[model samples]
Target: MTVTDTAPRALRTPRADRSNGQWKVDGRAALNGTEEFKAEDNGINVRERIETIYARDGFDSIPDSDLHGRFRWWGLYTQRKPGIDGGRTAQLEPHELEDRYFMMRIRSDGAALTPEALRVLGSISTDFARGTADITDRQNIQYHWIEIENVPEIWRRLESVGLETTTACGDTTRGFLGSPVAGVAADEIIDPTPVICEIKRRWLGNPELTNLPRKFKTAVTGHPSLDVVHEINDIALVGVVHPALGPGYDLWVGGSLSTTPRLSERIGVFVTQEQAPDVWHGVVRIFRDYGYRRLRNKARLKFLLADWGTERFREVLESEYLGYRLPDGPPPAPAVGPGDHVGVHPQKDGRYYVGAAPLVGRVGGATLAGLADLIEQVGADAARLTAFQKVVVLGVPEEGLEAFVDGLESLGLTARPSLFRRSTMACTGIEFCKLAIVDTKDSAVSVIADLERRLADLEPLLDRPIELNLNGCPNSCARIQTADIGLKGQIITVGSGSGTGSGGVQVPGFQVHLGGGLAGTGRDAGELGRTVRGLKVPATEVADYVERVVRRYAAERTPGQSFAQWVARADEEALQ
Candidate 1:
C-alpha cells in the first residue's frame, strides 16, 4: 500500500462559507507560491494557502484515492445563489448561458499565436471574473465562472500571461494532448508538435508524478490518422512508419471510459521517436508502483492491466525500465492511415486547417476571446483540439481560408455540419455533479434539440455516427458505456403519491442504453435498450423513441449500415 499508505479522504470543510463546500491545505501551504505571486497572503494559513497553491504548482502534497475536492471545487468556483457568488451571479445570461462550462482553443491556421499568448488570454478575461474561456476536449483553454477569492488573482493573471493553472486538473499529466492538426496535417505521419513539446517538458511540474492510482491520461498522435481518440489513453503514442522501425510510436495500453470500460491493451514494444519518454517512464512507474489500493472500484490504469495480465503488465514494465535501453523499434507500419481533424485540410507547409464545429462542446467568454483573437489574427503556427468537440485551425494561408471561414462566422462560431452537437456528450449533471441523477447538461441539450427537430426530413436516416451518452448517474461519469444512445439515470415511478411533491413529483428517469458502440470492430459495446419512463416519457417523447429508431433504420437499412450495425439487425421484438 505504499504511496504513503494510500492517502485521500479528509476534505469536508465548508461550514457555510456559503455551504455546498470543500477546503483543505497544508504541506507547507502548498509549496510557497511563485508562478508570479499570490500564495503569500499568509493570513495564518488556510491549510497553508491550500498547501502553497498545491506546491507552487508542481503538486502532490498528499491526498489520493482520486482526491476529489469536487474536482477542485468545480474546476475553480462557480456555484452560486447567495447574494450571487463572485462574478455577480447572473442566474444565467452571457448569451442566455445554458451552462456548458465555456471552451475555446484556437491556433490551427493562426499558427500557435503569441503576443505574450494573446496578452495572457486577454488578461484572463479582463482581470479574473472569467465568465468564459473554453476549448478543451483537449486542445486546451478553459476558464468558466472562476472565483474562489479570484483563484489567487486567477493564479496571478495566469502567471502574468505565460498562462497555466498547472497540469490543468488533478491526477497530473493532463493538457499535453496533441494534434489539432499537429505540424500541418496533409496526411502527416510524424510531427506531433515536437513530441508534444517533449511531453510538456517532462511532465509539467513533476513532483514525483503527482499522486495517482487514477486520473492520468496521455496522448500524442503523429497523425497515422485514427483521429485522436488515441486509444482512449492511459498512454497512447500512435503515428507509425517502421520500415525496419523508423518514424516511431505505437505504444497504446489500458484505454479508459470511467466506470470501468477498458479497451486499450497492446503493451510490449514499438516506441521510437526517441523512446517516448522511456515509454512514458515505464508506463508511469508501473501505475505508481503496483496500482490498486484496495479497490476504489478497481483503481484505473486499466485495473492495473487487468490485475497483471498483459504479459504480466509487460513484465513489470520491463522490470522498471531496467536502466532504460529498449528502443530497438521496428514493428509498426501495418496500415495506420485515415485522418479526421474533421473537414478542410492541406498543410505540409502550403498551409490550411479548418475543422470548426463547436456545438455541444459549447463556447462563450466572448466566444473564448474570439478564439484568442483568431490566434492573434492568424499566426500561432497552428492550433488544434479534436476528440470530436472540434477546433483545428493550424497554418491556413490559401489566402486565409476565406478570411478564416469569415472569422468563424463573425464570432458566433460554427464551421457548420450539425447533428445535435456532433453526437452529443453530457456530464456535469445535477447542475454540476454532486454525483448527478438528472439534468445532464439540460437533458443533453433537450434531447438533442428534439432529435434534431424530429430528424429533419429524415436526413439520410443512419449509416454511421450515432453516439448519444447522457450519464447523470451510474457514476460512469459520462462514458455511458461507450455511447450509441447510452443514457443511464434511473429512479422512475411517476405518480401514485408518497414520492413527495411540489414540482409535480415522480423522481428519476432515463435508462435507455441501446446498441452501445465504441468503434472497436465489434463496434463499441452497446446494449440494454428500453427503460424510458422519465415520468411517463417527455424528454421530447424520449427523443421520439430515438427518432423512431432512426426512421426505422432509414427504411429498413442495408448498404453499409452502422447505427451499431443496424442495432445488430433488429430483433427482440424489433428492439422493443
Candidate 2:
C-alpha cells in the first residue's frame, strides 16, 4: 500500500528528553516512591535475583521492593490469602491479605497455541499452580497458587513451549492482543499476526522499553469484526483498505479503561504493513519519554493524550518519533459482525474453526490437557483464545467436525452456547485478586446460569448478544464499562447505619452500568455505560436484578433495537 513520504525534521526541543538523565525524576526530585525505587534499579534485573536468591531462599527472603513492584515485571503477584472473604478485602493491608502463594501470568501474543504448547501450559498449571488457569481478556493465561520455589521451573516449562511472562504485567508494554482468528478468518482484511510477531520479536523483552511510567496495552486486529477490542487499547492498528493503497492499517492511539476510561482516537494516518513495527516502537518510546511519572494515577498514556490532544499527539509521533509523516487515512468501516467469533465458523481453507465458550475463561489444567488431546484426535491445526474468554479450535476437517464438537461438549465447552454463556465475562475477583471487593468468576457464572434459565423466553426478541462484563473492582480488568450490562464489584451498605448484622450492613455487591458498547459491537462509536444513581445490587440478588431489567427490556424495546440502543434511550424507571 502507498503512504506519504515526508522528510524528517531536525529535532529542536524533544519532549521525551524532558526528564533529562534522571530516570523517574522531573527536574530536581523523584515523582513518587515507585519512581524513587524504580530509578535505583532496573526492574528487569530482578530475574537474576529470583533465579539465584528468592527461588532458593523461599518467599520470606523477597524484599518488599521486589515483592510489591519488580515482581510484576515478570508477571508475578502475591495471590489473595485463602478463606479471605470479600468483606475483609479493603479492611486489611496488602501484606495482611496476601498469601505465600502467587499468581503468574503467561503472555500469549497472537492467541496462537499449538497442541504441544497447550500440553505444556496444562502441565505447568497442574504441577505448579494447583490446576488454576484462566484466560485473561488480553489473551494471556493466568495461574494462581504459584510459589516462588516453582517460578523458575514454570519459566523453563513455558520457555520450552516458546512462551514467557516477561513484560506481561507492570509498567511495561503488555501482551499485544490479536484476533484469535488472525490469519484464518474468512473475512479478514489483513492478517495482523506477522506485525504482532515482528513487534514481539524486537521489543518483547527489550530493556530499552522495559520500564514505562505505567502499563501500556497494545491491540492489533486485521479482522473486520475488530476482534482485539482496539478502541480500548493504548495503541491499536485497525485494518483498513485505502481506496488507492489497497489494504493497510489505520493508526489509533491512547485508548484505555480503568477508573479513568477513554476510547482511543484514530490519528488519521495510514501505515503500510512494513512500517507497523517501527511505528509501534516510536509510540511506545514517546510514552516512555514524555508520559506522566509524577503520580501513578495520571501516568497512563490516556492522560498524556488528553493533555496533548490527537492532533498534537500525531504531530509529535510523526515529527519527533517516526521522523516521517504518514499518509492521511479514513476511519475503519463499521464492524460487519460480532467481534467475539463464538460458535462454528468457516476458515479461509475448506477446513473449519469451532469457537467454544468455557464459562468466562475458566479452563482448568486437566481441561487444557484434554483440549490438546482433542486437537490431536480431531487433527485440528491449533487452539486459539479470544478476548471474550473463549477458545477456538482451528483447521478441524469437515469430516471430523462432529467428533470435535462432541469432544468439546464432553469437556463442558460449548460451540453453540446460550446467549448468556457466549457474552458474559468476569475478572478474577475476591477469589484470587488482592484488589477485588467482591466475587466475580463465580458471580458471572451464576449470572449466566440464572439468565440462561430466566430469560430463555426473551431470547427470540433479542437480535444481538447482550454483553455482561463483570469486574472485580473499579480497575475494569473485564472491560466493565464496554458491555451492555457492566457490573463493577463493590461492597455497599444495605441497611441504615446503626448496629451489626441486621441493623446496618456492608455487603458484597455491584454498581450497575448500562448501555456501554464498542463500534465492533454495533454502536457507530464506543460509548461508556451510564451509572444508575443510588443503585446497588447485593451479590446475592444480582441475578434477580439482571432478570428484572432484562425482562423489562424485552417487553419494551422497539423492533430491531439493540440492548445498548434501548438502554441509551430508556428511562431510569424502566432500568430500575
**Candidate maximizing TM-score:** 2
Which stretches of candidate 2 lie above 4 Å from their native place? Answer: 1-29, 496-502
Query: Tens-digit lDDT track for model 1 on 238-329?
Result: 77766676677877777776544666766656777766776777787667555543334455677667555667666667665645445433
Question: Which model scores highest in lDDT?
Answer: 2
Question: What TM-score does each of the candidates earn?
Answer: 0.30, 0.94
- Alpha carbon lDDT of each predicted model: 0.54, 0.86
Model 2: per-residue Cα lDDT over 62-127, one tens digit each: 999999999999999999998888778878999999999999999888757999999999998899
Distance (Å) between predicted and true CA of 485, model 2? 0.7
Model 2, C-alpha of 68: deviation from truth (Å): 0.7
Cα distance off (Å), candidate 2, residue 462: 1.5
